[model samples]
Target: MGDTNSDSPTASPEAAFEAPPTATVSLREDQLQNAVSFLSHPKVRSSAVEQKRQFLQRKGLTDAEIEEAFRRVPEAPAAAYVPAPSPHSVVAVPAGTVTPAGYVPVQQQQLVPAQPQPVRWGQAMLGAAFVAAGVYALKVVVWPYVADAVTKWKASQGEMAEAKALQEKESNALAEAIQAQTSELRNTVELLQKLTVSLEASVAESKRAAQDSLSLADLRAELRTLAGTIREQRPAAAPPAPSVDVGRELASIKQLLANGVGT
Candidate 1:
C-alpha cells in the first residue's frame, strides 16, 4: 500500500509533465503603441466600437490586446444636453391664480419696445467729410480737365468743318477754272478752224491766178509765132500801100495786149 501511494504520486507528477502547454500571445510595446494611436485616430474614434474592434481584428489583433489598446486610448469629451419644451405640451392654470414674483408676463415680453442704438456722430462726420472731399476733387480737378477736353473736341470739330468747307471751295474754284479753260480752248479751236478755211480758200485763189497767168503766156507765144510767119511769107517787090494804117493797127494790138495783162 505504501509503494502504491508513492507510485501514484509519481504518476500524477509525470501526467502533469506530459500535459500540453497553454499558448499565450503578447503584443510588442511598439505594436501596442501603434494600436493605441490607431484607436485614437479621429475617424476610428468616430466609428462604432464594434466596427473599430473588427477593423483591429483584421490587422491581426486579438480581442484582449484590442481591449488593452482601447484602455490606453483617451476618452472624448461628453457634450452637455439641453432640453427644449415641446410645442404641443401645455400646463393647466386657473384663471385668477396669482403669478410668481419674478416672472415676466407674456404680453409684456412680446410687446417690449426695442431700444434704439445711439447714432455715431463721428463716423457720420467722417463719411460727410469724405463725400465733400470727393465732390471738391470732382469739381476742382476732374471737371476742368473734362471741360477742357470737351472744348478741345469742339474746336477740333469746328476746325474740321472749316477745312472741309475750304476743300469744297477749292474744288468749286478748280471746276470753274477748268470750265473757263475749256471754253477758251473751244474758242481757240473754232478760230483755228476758221483760219484753216481762210487759208484753203486763199490757196485755191492763188492756184486759179497761176493758171490764168500761164494761159496769158501761152497766148503771147502764139501771137509771136503768127507775126514771124507773116514776115516769112511777105512779097520781096515794093507794092502800093493799103488804105488802112499799119502803125495805128499795131498800136491798137499793143493796147489790147496791155488790157488783157491788167485783167
Candidate 2:
C-alpha cells in the first residue's frame, strides 16, 4: 500500500494554494484615511514599494485592521487624490485684473477726469517775482529781530547752563558735607556704643562685687554671733587654788593611812 501511494501523482503545494483574493476586506473610514495619510508622508513616498497592508502594520495598525483598510483603499478613486500645491509654485492674480475666457469686462463706473491743466510760464514767473519780493522784505525787516531774538535765547540758555552748573557744584559740596557728617555721626555712635557697653559691664561687675560684699558681711556677722554664743555656753570652772588645796588634803590622808590608823 505504501509503495502504491508513493507511485501515485501528488498535488504541488503552489497548485493547492488558493488564488489571490479580489474582494477587499471591509474597513472603517478613519482607518482608510490613516493608511492614505501614512502613504502621503514624504519618507513613505520615497521608501521601497511594499504591500499596503504591511505599510499600515508599520504605522501601529493591527493586521486584521490593516487587511480591512486595504480592502477599502482600492475603492477610493485615483482622481480623488489631488497633489498638495507647493506654496512657492502657486501664484494668485488679482480678481479685478483677471477676466474669464471670452468675458467682456463691463464698465463698473465711468472713469474720473484727469487732474487740472498745467500753469502757463507767465503766471509762474509772476508767482516767482512775488515770492522773491516777499523774501527780500523779510530779509531786510524781519531778519534783524529774528537774529536779536536768537542771540537773546542763546544768552539766556548760557545763563541757565551756568546756573545749573553752580547748582550742581553746590549739591556736590552739600553731598560731601552730608557724607562727612554721616561718617562722623557713625563714629560718634560707635564710640558711644563702646562706652555704653563698657559702662554696662562695669555696672554688672560692681553689682556682683556688691552682692559678694553683702554675702561676706553676712558671713562675718554670723561668725561673730556664733563665737559669742560659744563663749556664753562655756562653763566657768572653780578657782585653781581650791583644786590644789583638795589635792594636798587627799595626799595627807593617803600618808596617814599608810602610817596605820590608831597606833
Candidate 3:
C-alpha cells in the first residue's frame, strides 16, 4: 500500500521524494507540464480538493491529504534559449603564430544570399491571351449549340405532354362510346326477348281459340234449322204485321253473306 501510494502523482511532493529507493519513477519536463495543466484547471482542482477532503476525513488523513489536494502543483518552467556561435563568427588562431606590433583580430560576417526576382511578363501575357481566346471560343462555338439543344429538348417535352393529354382524352371518348354501345346492345336484346315472348303468347292464344271454335258448316246448319222452326210455328192464315219489313231484312242478310262474313 505504501509503494502504491508513493507512485501516485497526487502524493505530496515530500511523500513522492521519500519513495523507496527501489521505486525508480522518472517524469520528463513535458509530462510535468501536462500534469500541472491538468491539475490546475478550475473544475478539476475544486472537485479533486473536495473528494480528497472527504476521503481523507474518512481515512484519518485530514491534514496531509487536504493540504496535498490544495497545494500548488509544480511544473517544468520554460528555459531561456541561448544560441551557440556560428562557425563564420569564430576566429581561429594558429598554435605558434607571431603577430605584428599592431595586430587586430578580424571578425568574419555571414553574407545572406539575395533572392532572385522572377521575370514572367511574356509568359503571363501569353497565358492571359490563351485564357481570353478560350473564353471567346466558348462564347462563340459552344454556348449557342448548347442553347439550341436546350430549346429543342424543351419543345420536345412540351409536345410529349400535349400528345399524352390528347391520348388520354381520346381514350376517355372511346371508353364512353364502348359503354354506350354495350347499353344499346343490352336494350336491343331485352326488346327482342320481349317481342319473342309476346309472339309465343299470341301463338298459344290463337291455338286455344282454334280448338274451342265451332266449324263453319255446323254454324250454317244450325242457322237453317232455326229458320225452319220459325216458319213452322207460324199459323196458316195469319195476318201480316205492318211494322215487320221482311223484304229489307232478307236483302241485308244476303248482302252480309256476300261480303264473306264467316270465312
Candidate 4:
C-alpha cells in the first residue's frame, strides 16, 4: 500500500537538476572608460550604491560592467592641515651683528601680484568673421527652403478651402433644382386631376341631354298616332268643319319641337 497523505514521509528517487549556463557579454574599452568617468563624478560618488547602480543602468551599462567601473574609480585624496605662524612672534638676531639698510624680515616679505595678459585683436576679429559667415550661410542655404515650404503649405490650404466652398455651392444648387422640379410635378398632377373631374362632369351632362331628347321624340310619335286615329273615326253624312284643323295643330307642335332641339 502506498501513502496518499500530503504529509507522508515516504521518499521518492532523487532527481538531479543542472543550473542554466550564464551568458557573458564583451564590452568595448571606451564604454568601460565612460562608465568609470560617470562613477568618479563627485555628485555620483556621494549617492548611495543602489542609486548609482540605477543611474548606470539608465545609461545602458549592464550589472557586470557597472561593478567593474566601480572597481576602477579612483579614490579621493584626504585633506591635510598646516599651522599658520603667529603675527606677534619676534625675530632672533646675533649679538654683535649690524642690521643692513632697507632689509625686511623673512616673515614680512609680501607676495608679488600677477600681471594681466594682453588680449589678441587678430584672434577676436577672426572669431567675429566666423560668426558672420555662419549667419550668412544660414540665410543663403536654409532660409529659402523654409520659406518655400511655408508658402506651399499656405497655398494648399487655400486650394482646399476653395474646393470645399465650390462643393457646398454645387450641393445648394442641386437641392434648389430638385425642389423646383418637385413643385412643378405637384402642380402638373393637380392640373391633370382638375381636367379629369371636368371631363367626368361633361360626360354625365351629355348622357342627361341624350335621355331628354329620346323622351321628346317618344311624345312626338304618340301625338301623331292619336291624330291618325281621330281622322279614321270622322262621320261621312255631315260636311267637314273648318274651325278646328288637326293638321295645323300638328304642324305647330312640330315647329315647337324644332325650336327646343335648336336651343
Q: Highest TM-score: which candidate?
A: 1
Q: Cα deviation in Å at residue 218, candidate 3?
A: 10
Model 4 RMSD, rounded to 1 decimal: 23.5
State the lDDT of candidate 2 residue by residue for 96-184, as single tens digits: 88667996544345467899998799999999999999999999999999999999999999999999999999999999999999999
- Cα error of candidate 4 at position 243, Å: 25
Q: Against the true structure, what is each candidate's TM-score? A: 0.44, 0.39, 0.38, 0.36
What range of 10 consecutive residues in model 3 has the weakest lDDT sum?
A: 13-22
lDDT (Cα, tens digit) per residue for candidate 3, span 179-216: 99999999999999999999999999987666445344
lDDT of 4 by residue, 70-127 (tens): 7887556556877776665557668798889976656645567888979999999999
Kindly report which residue pairs in candidate 2 clash with one another: none
- Expressed as tens digits, the lDDT of each residue in 54-114 for candidate 1 is 7677666667777888888866767889787555545555789987888654431234578
Q: Assess candidate 2 and give its lDDT.
A: 0.62
User: Which segments of candidate 2 are over 4 A away from where they belong?
Assistant: 1-136, 237-263
Candidate 3: clashing pairs of residues: none
Overlapping backbone residue pairs in candidate 2 total: 0
Report the number of clashing residue pairs per model.
Answer: 0, 0, 0, 0
Q: Please identify which of the two predictions, 1 or 4, would achieve the higher lDDT against the true structure.
A: 4
Give candidate 1's whole-model lDDT. Answer: 0.69
| Model 3: residue 212 alpha-carbon error in angstroms | 2.5
- The residue ranges of model 4 lying beyond 4 angstroms of the native Cα positions read 1-124, 203-263
Against the reference, the lDDT scores of all candidates come to 0.69, 0.62, 0.61, 0.70
Deviation of model 4 at 136, angstroms: 1.5
